[model samples]
Target: MTFAFPVVPRYSEIDQQGVVFFGHYLTWCDEAFTAFQASVGYPYPEMIADGVDIQIVHASLDYGSSVHWGDLVELVVENEKVGTTSLTSRVSVRRRSRSDEGWSDAVTVQLVHVCVDASAFTKVPVPPRLVEGLAAARA
Candidate 1:
């Protein structure tokens, strides 16, 4: 399943060259990941409270184009893979002119997170609820 998260870059996020700074895309990816989980009833804080948490093991971004400060960025997030102790999420950064009718892919971000015991920070199997939620949320 795919989840949609929208963001408009803050003026501060733009670089001196007038395009969005490369670093901000990662922030958006993280936000989208959290939002996606919350949408699935697995909010981060609540998960930690339950002694289950997810920790990022890797993140990668492939840039295809530049996005200006005002462009509309729609982050298309979905679970790419799920394993016994880890999961991967892919986020497509779709950017468009503020008044345009269509979007173009600006960046592709992939994040891999491992499930862990909150207290011990040791790897653990992905929770069944998360597995079921991701299965249902797949598009």
Candidate 2:
């Protein structure tokens, strides 16, 4: 299952060459993830209020094509692997423009997030509620 988010590229997100900066890909991924969680009824604020926090343990991105300012991008987020306490999400970004029509994979990213106790900062099992929420979102 994939969650799609429409993204509007900002001028500040681009470099001098008029292409999105490499580091901005990570920020895009983060935004997509947050949107995914919210769509699944597990918004970050609610999770934090419940003493649960997810921290990125690992992240990587591969840029295949350049995204310029004003290009609308669709960020597709999916679960690559889900474990007891950690999960890896795959994010694919595609530029929504005729010139970049063939660029179905402008960027591909993988991020591993570990569920943790906010106060203790120790890894914890992902709550059943979250799992159910994600499952429902997929459905």
Candidate 3:
């Protein structure tokens, strides 16, 4: 994992089944991506200021288990791949049991973001600096 972002399940996010709603997992993934970028020192605002930005072109999730309302969930993030103008990130959601401190896989999500011109919002080449940043994060 390149970075970790922790989030506690809140009551407002719970569904009728007493588990975290399925959709919230996506939000957590997005938040984790933001945190990941900041960790690499190319936060969204800075990236934009540098005339580059990213937009999600696709996302897919596979569920292993449900996250309960009281579970301690952590999103383990990693940049899986980078294309000429796109990037793919893997955000693994794990629920850590408080009693035993063991983690159970909850969801695996792949978020593909395309690099774009900050002002035009058109496709753009991935910056070399960004590439190096991702590599650093991978370490």
Candidate 4:
């Protein structure tokens, strides 16, 4: 499954040239990731409390266009891949004048996270529940 989050660039998030700062897109992706986890019933804090955690091992973003202040951004999040100890997620950033209209792709981001033992910070297999949740989301 794919999850979409609506984001609006704050005035401070805009650069001098009036476009959103590159770094802010990453922030939006992270926010979407968090929301995705919550929607899947295993938020970060809950995972940590269970002695399991996910750490970002890599993040990549490709820009296709610029987003300006007041432009509505739809951040789409979905599972790209899942491994024994890692999960890769794809986030597509799109812009639309209204929710009912067509969207234009602005950026695409890939985030890879490795499952780890919360205390030792060592690699570990993803929890069964999380695995099932992600699998269901991907379906």
Best by lDDT: 1
Give the TM-score (vs. native) of candidate 1: 0.95
Misplaced by over 4 Å in model 3 are none
Question: What TM-score against the true fold does each predicted structure earn?
Answer: 0.95, 0.90, 0.94, 0.93
Which residue pairs does candidate 4 place in steric collision? 1-137
Query: Comparing 2 and 3 by lDDT, which wins?
Result: 3
lDDT per residue (tens digit) for residues 1-139 in model 4: 6799989889999999999999999889889999999888788899999999888899999989888887888899998788999999999999865443678999999999999999999999988888888888877
Cα lDDT computed for each candidate against the true fold: 0.91, 0.86, 0.89, 0.89
Put down candidate 1 lDDT per residue, 30-114, tens digits, no spaces: 9999999988878888888888999999999999999998898899998989999999999999999979899999999999999
> Residue 130: error of model 4 in Å?
1.1
Clashing pairs in 1: 1-137, 1-138, 1-139
Model 3, residue 9: distance off in Å is 1.1
| Tens digits of lDDT, candidate 3, 44-134 | 8888889999999999999999888778899999999989999999889999766746898889999999999988999998887889899
lDDT, model 4: 0.89
Q: What is the C-alpha RMSD of each candidate to the true structure, in Å?
A: 1.2, 1.7, 1.3, 1.8
After TM-score superposition, the amount by which residue 115's alpha carbon in candidate 4 deviates from its true location, in angstroms, is 1.1
Minimum summed lDDT over a 10-residue window in model 1 is located at 130-139
TM-score computed on alpha carbons, candidate 4: 0.93
